[model samples]
Target: MNNNVKASINAVIVSAVFGAVQVANAAFIEDSKLTLGMRNFYYDNDNREGGADQREWAQSFKLDYSSGFTEGFIGFGVDMQSLVGIHLDGGKGYHPDSNTFTPSDSDGSATQEWSSFGATAKARISQTEFRVGNTLTPSLPILIATDSRLQPQTFGGAMFTSKEIDNLMITGGQLERAKGRASTNSTGLSVPGGTEESNHFRFAGADWKVTKDLMLQFYYANLEDFYTQHFFGLIHIQPLGERQSFKTDLRYFKSSSDGKNGEPGYRFNNNGGYAKNPGEVDNTTAIAMFTYTFQSHSLMVGHQRVSDDGSLVWLSQANVVNGSGRNEGEGGISFYSFTDAMIGNFARAGENTTFGQYTYDFADAGISGLKASISYLRGEDIKAVSGSGPDLHEVETDLRIDYVVPEGPLKGFGTTLRHGVYRGGGTSIDDQDQTRLIFNYTYSFF
Candidate 1:
């Protein structure tokens, strides 16, 4: 049988097996949770600097099932997710050039429908848990999964998390491959400008709560043949008054080239910015932020700086498929940084970004489930790889509003609207405007 046919049969078998096991084991049935989710997504991006516009609309569904561990010193359980996406709008003129929303067909057209299924088997013992299979492993400072499109990305991997030590949490994992949000195919890992593929991504991290209001974290990651990275973070919160508080956050990352990074298949693109040593990775980045929260209002300000050697390090596969050009399908990425904005990420060699945000929650005004926020970011002093040029600069502004139905039949329904404007100077940077409208609802069947 074909792979798709086999996958379908396996899904059916898994559903039946889980259903039977639930009925056989009272713990499994009693603790299991099943949820069905629906999402209506509309996206539009206008490149003011001259490029084809990207626009698309789609409807998606997700079926998630998670069972509790059975009784024993080493209990076992299972988790499954089935995802489906259907094209709702966007014809030839509005098809995506970045392939950010929909997968491309053999004729370079959007597919009518796509689906994916994944399952993870887990075991728990003495406050630690082990999970294996297709998993959405928790997001880490080193590898943040992309979930901006119709279906969240999933990776084929195994991970272990432990909270056995008081006031501390530890995590470690090995991931082999990833399925993008828009495509049903799973692909090996690689960075931008890379032609070779790597199936191994290893990482370990720990978070220690030093005090009631202070926490410290350290993490290390190695992407085979790409690079190795170390991250450090600190967060502290202090009570100012009955309804006021102060918060501080600091983050740092140090990265260096790994085996084969400068080889033919593992080269770095330098991403328009200058790399002190082309094709090799070497960079340091730091960010600090302070926030004040009073009642329903919050104000935050932060600054980030990247070392002069290379662009900040993160997993990006923008050029891995279809030979490092535009119109390739299934490209999206995410990172754990304050400068990771909706329209752009202000991370480049010698770049400095200053940003701030203001937010208000309507709960204090008797409007529960309603909130709004606005943010602005300015980046400058970006170094060019050519070693001779004026410094580049950019600015981005974003506005967001979120609302969830508080009661009635649509009590659980939610709506989110976001708009972003970006203007910059550089070969890689572009002036653009983007908007997203999303409606989502989740129903439980348990």
Candidate 2:
């Protein structure tokens, strides 16, 4: 973290402590909650075509504390989190540059250990709350924090959420920096092919529940010097029978170039595609999904479409956006989309993806703590808008199973297994397979 950022966070912490003490209310301490979580993760990836396999094993500790508000017209609270990762395995050549489970060293190797600390100071008035500092996961469709790795991603920013009106939520935020999932340092924001770092990311959105079964959403986000994006969404659920239901989800995003997009250090290649308006952002992406559920079984089908003019845009600090080669750890990012799957995002220019999944709960068969799911995504008819070479295609399959202890001393313990297979040509690697095993346990102290 930078010195100025550190100082600002410390100042906020001190102010929050002082405010709590001055309020003379025990609610801040009486309603506080603390949790100690442990995660053991093992990741293995194999290139079916060639190259060495990538494998890494690590143990992570997460300490989280959340305090209730102090008494008053405006209540004050604080939230703190500390994450530590200790490497258990991953010998020489096991840690690939793209692997984000462990921190990368100066020599492109995995470090033995890494850690980070963050805190959020918050105030609440009525149904609205304002917060500043590190928020682990943001509930925004334009940006998402990846938690698939050992340590989840976090952003340093100030955000406000208002739920004063019934069935309506208003959210807006300004984000300046982000700490990657594996890195201890924070960096500015940019897209995949953007070389310039834009510290300012602004977004505002609202969600309105029109009825008990339908909701509408509209959001706008701008990444300075990168792109401006707008999102529109609709979700509806219908009950068919006593044990049957159906759901519909529709999402759309339109993005255009912002300031300095075509200038030096701000140029984008559209993720190596032929951008119709070179260095300028212009794209539209849409996805629709329908699901049917009956008792213990659920099935879904979805399709995603990307405009030919340019690729989709989201904020990511990866690829050394500022043209600095010193920070390689900030290479992992996640976007808010259904296609952000286990193996691939399937979000290239001109790509049309069709996918499906089937999930089942083993409780129907007397196994109360087990669930399994499998999904497949196929993308085709992809071509550059500038009339580049041949059209591209890709395919991915994923399988996942989770188990949680039902009771006894290990009630909060859980185990998850995931496997994925990816195959493609342009913009994607050759044939590849990946597997992950995770064990997690959390204990809470009030």
Candidate 3:
């Protein structure tokens, strides 16, 4: 075993022993979970220019224990998580240039696999809780948790959540570093490379419910020297019929250079627009998506517009939009970077895309855990749009299948297959048929 492996095991053992002691001393063990899974991908990058097929395996474990108030006004608790990954296939040639999903070996070849385990101390009062250590933070308009791979991305930070007010939720946090999806190594926030400092990412947000079917959200984040983002969102769910519902998601984001807008202590729109100041880019984006569901069939369509001089803040929890996840080409059409990034950065100045998708659940047909969907998006005036110039159009489609064991030790076992096709203008060095095959049997031990 290497030093990294040794350290991971040691950490898990230490947390286990510590939890055991707490249990022996009468602490309540509230929750515990374990999941082992694998994801295999038959990927083609740069439109068949490069292809790598491999099966990646990951194992995850989590345990939580909360104590009753000791001083009546104060409460305490502990949370622990252990994550490990193993390389089933794909060598260095298969790995991407960025270090978001997996790690690189010292020999330049693919390392067998890596693991990371972490624990956090918790404190609570009335309806507010504070936690310190490493965990999963899926902040929209900024950092998002990616679970399309065998493992999920994690973060090391201190977070505070409060529910003192009625019908409103407030969240705030300060993150120091981010742990990649497949490796134990943690990194500071950056656009893609390790060229920036670690203490650059910070965020805060609030969500309020206006009515039973209406909700609103606001968020702010700073990526240090890179950029700062502000987001606003609205969601409404309405029942159309006995078994039909319509959901509307409207989101807007304004982004600009922060701390260093080409100068220290100066942050604004200095890039002037996309590709103009390729050295430093910024912009604002808005999206309004509407989905209607009836029985097991659903249809969704939306229009997204990226204004000049601001960057689109992709998110997960609430702000960032979905549907763009199953693009086929590495850059041509789709944008599914959350789980497995095929479109690393899908942004261009003054770009606008009209998107539509259709989905069906096989459960209505008496099949469970089986779903299928197809989507298409056409973008215009991307990268360089001069009032009425050339337009870029992209089309993408996907087919997926999922199956899980219903009972026994393999109860949580399941698999997923995703295939896509992307095409359009200014593909940015990416085009071709791409397929990712992920099959994993999850085992839950509580």
Candidate 4:
């Protein structure tokens, strides 16, 4: 880690210890909770074409500590998170020298191990809470942290949330930097093809429950010199019978160019797809999803359409290099859309995607703690990068199974297996098949 990060962590530790001792209250000590989480992951990818395959296995440990608020009208507390990852196996030629899964050594090989540490200080008053920290993980409609890898990505920022009104929640925040999942350092925010970094990311949103089964959402976000985005969402559920229900979800996004966007070094790649105005952000996306549940089965279907002007935009630091002129493995992002699939994101320009999923809960069949799901997505009418050619196409299918040990010595232990197959034509993405197996367990201490 760098000197700045080390100093921040040390200061947090000192403050946490001193504050707890000074308070000397039951709420601060007796209600504190700590948990240790472990995950073992194995990943494999096979390229159908003559490309390099990626296979890696690793184990990660996370220590999370949360302290209860002190006794006061304005309660105060602290939270800390520590993570460590160890590479178990990734033979030569199998582990690519990319920050996608693991940090790379100077020799272009996987690093043996990596670790990170962060802390947050928070205060609560009435129905509102304010927090400032380097471990913020926001799940707003405009920006969502990525946690698909061994470590969850984190942001350094300050935020506030208010729930003073019944059935209403308001949230806003400003994030300055982000820590990549596979690296120990933090970097500024940018987009997929942006080389220059921007430290300002501001967002505000509200969720209002209009009725017992209907909710509405609206949010706005801006990334300095990158893009400004607005989001709207609606969700409704209708009960059909004792064991059956239907859900409807709708989402829409509008994005446009921000300050200095389309300039050299701050260009948007349009997700490597077509762009009406090269390097400029101008797009709108609409999505609708419906789900029906009956007994032990659930089915979901969705459709998404991207504007013909540009691809969708989101906050990313993938292309930003650290001071050492090397990537810090900060390359994964999650958008609040169903098109953000396991193997591919179907958010290219002028693209139309149709997708569906089927899931089963084995508990209804006397097999508790077991579940399975399969999904498929096809994207067509994708404009080529040149903006004047035959439309491109891509498809992906994913299968997943999950199980947890229940009512046994290994209770709470969980296992997951996932496989995805992707095929594409006339796009930069290649055909590939990927699989992942993961084991997770956590123990708590109070």
Strongest candidate by TM-score = 4
In model 4, which runs have C-alpha deviations exceeding 4 angstroms? 1-24, 323-325
lDDT of 3 at 445: 49
For 1-446, candidate 1 gives per-residue lDDT tens digits of: 99999999999999988886665487766899999999999999998978888888999999999998886577889999998999888867788555678877665667789888899999999899999988565688888887877778788889999999999999999888877777777777777777677888899999999999999999999999999999999999999999999999999999999999988889987666789888889999999999999999999999999999998878755344554343334477788987889888888889999999999999989999999999999999998668778988889999999999999989989999999999988748679999999999999999
Q: After TM-score superposition, what is the CA distance of residue 129 in candidate 3 from its true location, in Å?
A: 1.7
- Cα shift from native, residue 135, model 3 (Å): 2.0
Q: What are the TM-scores, per candidate, against the unseen true structure? A: 0.92, 0.92, 0.77, 0.94
Alpha-carbon error at 55 in model 1, in Å?
Answer: 1.2
lDDT of 4 by residue, 1-446 (tens): 99999999999999998887677577887779999999999999898887989999999999999888876788889999999999999989888766888888877789899888999999989999988999999988999999898888999999999999999999998999999888888888998889888989999999999999999999999999999999999999999999999999999999999999999989999988999999999999999999999999999999999999999999997475655556888788899998888879999999999999999999989999999999999999999898887999999999999999887889999999999999998777789999999999999986
lDDT of all predictions: 0.86, 0.86, 0.58, 0.92
Error of 3 at 411 (Å): 2.8
What does each candidate score in C-alpha RMSD? Answer: 8.2, 8.1, 10.8, 8.2
How much lDDT does candidate 1 score?
0.86
How far is 382's C-alpha from truth in model 1 (Å)?
A: 0.2
- Who wins the lDDT comparison? 4
Clashes of each: 1, 1, 10, 0
Instruction: Flag the better candidate by TM-score, 2 or 3.
Output: 2
Clash list (residue pairs), candidate 3: 47-431, 148-339, 282-309, 282-310, 283-309, 283-310, 283-311, 284-310, 327-334, 413-442
lDDT of 2 by residue, 50-81 (tens): 87778999999999999999888889999999
Supply the global lDDT for candidate 2: 0.86
